[model samples]
Target: MPLFVKDFSWEQTDKVVFITVPLKGVKASNVDIFSSEEYLKVSFPPYLFECFLYDTVEDTDSVAQVGNGTVVFKVLKKEPGKWPQLQSDVIDNKEAMKVKRTEAFAKAEEKLKEQSKLKAEQKRANEQYALKEIMKAEEEERNRIERVKQSERQKATEELEKWKEEQRLAAEKEKERLMEERRKEEAAEREARKEQEKILKRQTRGKKANIFEQNAEGAPKREVGKISVSFTHRQFPTPERESVKPKEEEWLKKQAEARRIVELEDENLSEEEKNPMWLRDKGNEFFKAGNLEAAINAYSHALRLNHTLHSCYSNRAACHLKMRNFFKCIEDCTRALELLVPPVPQNADSRVKCHVRKGTAFCQLEMYVEGLQDYEAALKIDPNNQQIKDDAEKIRHLIQTETVE
Candidate 1:
């Protein structure tokens, strides 16, 4: 007997099915259907039918059956070109379809899980990249600050050096200024000393004259025509000694007479007449006695009496030159030169002597160029004087050496 279960739901397959049953007169209690229970076998025709059956047992052996339960299965209509072919095994087809749906759902769920994991990893990677960029930026900023600091340090150092250089220059300038001022002050002091010496010599002239007179008594005396003369002998005797002796005697006698005349003049003088001329005559007496100090004193006194007296200046200058007082000698000679009359006569040997004296003083002072010029002028006047020529040659040599240096 064939039995049909209509509107049957298969829980495993999850599908609705239409079933057909055919009756072959089999005993319903002997059929295996639903649970292990007595069943009613209801058979249908070849058309599809939708119904269900239930069985109720009153006792272990007695059974009551119910049929045509209210469950329905709707069949989809076929299009005109489609053939409606029924599955030979509908339950198997439904089970396969159910398995495919479960597999597809599981595959979709796995794909979703994989996608979520990828997104999480990407987020973490992005965060790490951002952190790296932040670190790089910070490092760059730190380096920039360091560079700025270095630049500032360099600039500050340069400024400090420049200021130091300026300070050094300023100090050097101040020092040079001070040195120049000192030099000028020293020059002024020297000039003042020379003037003071001149004044002192004038005051001491009479004292020097008395000293020379006292000293003259011990000197060697020669007699010439009732005149007694005293003079210092030359250190080296000259080849012209014989010719020089007569001239020397005459010069000595004249000097002694001049001295006597001066002394007598002083004794006879009223205090008013004992003036600059008297001092000059006394100076001449001392000069002839070879008393340079007294001669200088007397000349200085004469100069004090008349500053315009060129002869006094020249005489004093000669005394200073003998004493190796070159600066004072130059000072007096210069004063005498300034006071000299223009158009100096050809016979004015005193002026020429002053020039020669000045040149000697300049040479001693190491004013070589000026000394050379003075010597040259003296040479022009006294061309035959070997002494003047020798002095000029020496000064010229000095000037040449100085120029080469």
Candidate 2:
């Protein structure tokens, strides 16, 4: 029997490449390999590598060459037991070979379909496995970050606790130090008070002893005297009485003449009976009577009449000072200074008096600088005046002390 290529080959003519027989003396019906023209024309799916040829003759030759001899063959209508089974001879039955070719092609196509399905299933499994691995790696990275953050939080908590403990200890130590300082201060104050009390008691005892000694030294002394007395009586004559009466009449006549002259002067007075110096005299009377308000009014009235009256303003300033109206005193003093004219050489005493009064008003107003200037000017004019000299010294001391401060 001759055998051909079971799978079709596009490059080979009539689906036969190099044919060979496995036996030589076999009948065509008993051969193991055979071929048909219809089988050569069949198309096989790509998965089928070979096909079986069956129900053919057996051969005795070890190998027989194809197309070497003519042999009659009939195709059998039977399915092969297995792929690659042998057939006896080549056949020319186109119908039966066509049916066998169709069955073989259907089997080859079924195997190809099964292989494609298995490959698709394997690809799906591989993708699922890759996805699972990626998810597991992401979870591990997240867990690692959480662990690092937890470690940092623990470190910060420990540090905070340590700082708080240090602060607590520092506060306790400071409190103890302050308490110790307060205790020492209280003890020092108590000792100082005791020393001050002892000094006061010693001073009181010394003052009492001095008073007793002064009284003993200034005591009064007494003296006694004796005297003798005598009495006499006499009668006076009428002629001696007449001589005494005439002397009395002569004294009365001189008094009457004096009275007549004062009457004549009164009758010759002017229409304005009031004196030009009335305001000043009335102000003086009020001052003597201790009526400071009336005295100031009278002095002011005198100034209104004659603005040049420096004495009235100065006297009114004195009254304002006595009433403790220091601002009013300063005003009056200022007015007096504006009205006062420079005095003649012989009237230096009056100028000095005015300056003293103005200085006293300045001191009352607490105008220390002006007050000291006035006192200095008054001392230059009347250095021997004790009151002016004392006032100038006092003002000088006040100015020096204030400047030092």
| TM-scores of the models, in the order given | 0.32, 0.31
lDDT of 1 at 60: 28
Q: Candidate 1 clashing pairs?
A: none
lDDT of each: 0.61, 0.59
Candidate 2 runs further than 4 Å off: 1-276
| lDDT (tens digit, per residue) of candidate 1 on 127-166 | 9999999999999999999998677556645654776799
Off by over 4 Å in 1: 1-273
**Deviation from native of the Cα of residue 118 in model 2, angstroms:** 99
Local error of candidate 2 at 189, Å? 79
Report the C-alpha lDDT of model 2 over 186-266, residue by residue, as the tens digit.
998898778777766675664653433433568642222235586432233345435576666677767775565455345
Model 2 residue 327 distance off true place after TM-score fit, in angstroms:
2.8
